[model samples]
Target: MCGSDLHYYRAENDGTPAESRCIGGHEPAGVVESLGPGVNGARLSVGQRVMVHHYSGCGTCMNCRSGWTQMCTSAPAKVYGKNAHGAHAQYMAVPAACVLPLPDELSFCAGAAIGCGTGTGWGALERLGEVGGLDLVVFGQGPVGLSTTMLATARGARVIAVDPSASRLEQASKFGAADTVNPDSVDPVEAIRELTAGAGAAAAVETSGATVAATAALDALANWGRLCAVGLGGTIAFDVRTFLSRQVTAMTSWSMSSVQQMACADFVARRNLPVDDLFSHHWSLDEAVPAYEEFDKQSAGKAAFVF
Candidate 1:
């Protein structure tokens, strides 16, 4: 589930890592082997292939009623790999409401990617609003950041990608990034300003989850520009006065809702986006731990655990 599983598995008591011994994996695509009695009327039938939303909320919560189940506040929501057993096993039992039917044409791996990384990108794009013709900057070239770059570019935005790895920058360029910046060699903010004709980017998506990357993204936004933070890195301090003077808006984007996740999956299928290109490595469950270690090492492209 985005390589964070390793952190939790290695350190059980750390605040950043949950103290659960459950099988790890939140992004799952599988067939419905059986249905609980309560979900019988929800239209989910056996033998139907589907993707699990991985996060379930109490139906009576205000957030759930408002169609934003991701924000449910009543009960401690159950999420794969965090609060409950995840889908790394052959079979995962999930609430019926958290499952989405997958078109036969979509591959299981592609469906799994959408459940988390791609869905997060879709949500961030929704939060930014109207990205057409905007100069966009993505701070990292991981799966989430690369997905954002593809979506933003498809929407007619000129994208500038920033990452310390040359290989990732090259991959980002292949995914429609108009320009690439390596923060290790140059000041990313200055490079972004130069690329945007001294105005900086119209919108910036920070997916590096590092304090330095967050600061750079904030500094690279133009006046009144929008900065959407999607990374899982720890917090960082920012100067309110600087943002106030520039009229910049800083927003944090969490995982997407079920609706948005489904919408993204539909968009990918309709447009025939290159989902295959995003996956560069694959491993079975027995290889999962080593696969995650390689992912943590920042291997050149996306990695997936195959069934």
Candidate 2:
């Protein structure tokens, strides 16, 4: 499931931290039990292993017709754990269009990540254009950030990871971070510039939900560089003059499209990008409360509640 689930569970409707009695989880992988009448039987068999994309758009929306369902404007978008019931339970009902077939070699846990974490990174990179041979800096070493680092590294780009935790930085290093910057000790912008031989990074993926990290990433971007802000966090002040002078292109990315999710599953299957390492811990469904506590404290990496 995405980190937003943890946020919702820890913070109730008062806009502050409180216990949530609701069942919460979105990243789900299971066998298809049924399909609607309009869906082809051959396209999705009842017993096939599959994962669900958490976001669904109204089929008749202009955005959906244009293959941009994630940004559907005509109708209200349904996001699991937000607008509707999530997948933490044993059974979940999802639109057939949101279902994607999982590869035999991938586990349910890995497939779960593909739908959101990995797919979001893929969408961000796709929006950034060519990244091969470019120097990339990924802020925050969470699932989405680390996935971006791994994907960019796999594409033959040099990646520099920035985070506060040394443990997370170490994990990013294993995923091919050429350099790690802990902002607690050094100025991340200066460090990134030093690593890039004073040219700054060509692209940056900011996944840290902190304003400081976002500002640092933007400040360290090279001329004509693209910055994709994927994290949902506090606002940060930006220097408009610097942005215009440097000609930095900054954009925000949400969850991946259904097609991107499929491509991510295939990429993970082909490259065998260390998905197992992403899960630092696992718990039974009964231990969901403790799981949420641990996640709220940021004491673990990617976690899953096994059935």
Cα lDDT of all candidates, in order?
0.84, 0.84
lDDT of 1 by residue, 18-110 (tens): 333677788899899988877865578889989978788896787876556667898777878777889888788887888898877789888
In angstroms, the error of model 1 at 78 is 0.8
| TM-score (C-alpha) between model 2 and the true structure | 0.93
User: Which residue segments of model 1 deviate by more than 4 Å?
Assistant: 12-19
- TM-score of each candidate structure, all chains considered together: 0.93, 0.93
Q: Which regions in candidate 2 have their CA more than 4 angstroms from the true location?
A: 13-22, 36-38
Q: What's the residue-level lDDT of 240 in candidate 2?
A: 87
**What is the per-residue lDDT of model 2 for residues 1-307, given as tens digits with 9 covering 90 to 100?**
5787866775663475334344567788889887778888878998899988887898677777654676888777877766677788878888887788999889999998887787778888988888999999999999988889888899788999999899999999999999999999999999999999999999999887788888888889999888998889746567687577888888888777777788888988899888767898888877877777787877668888777
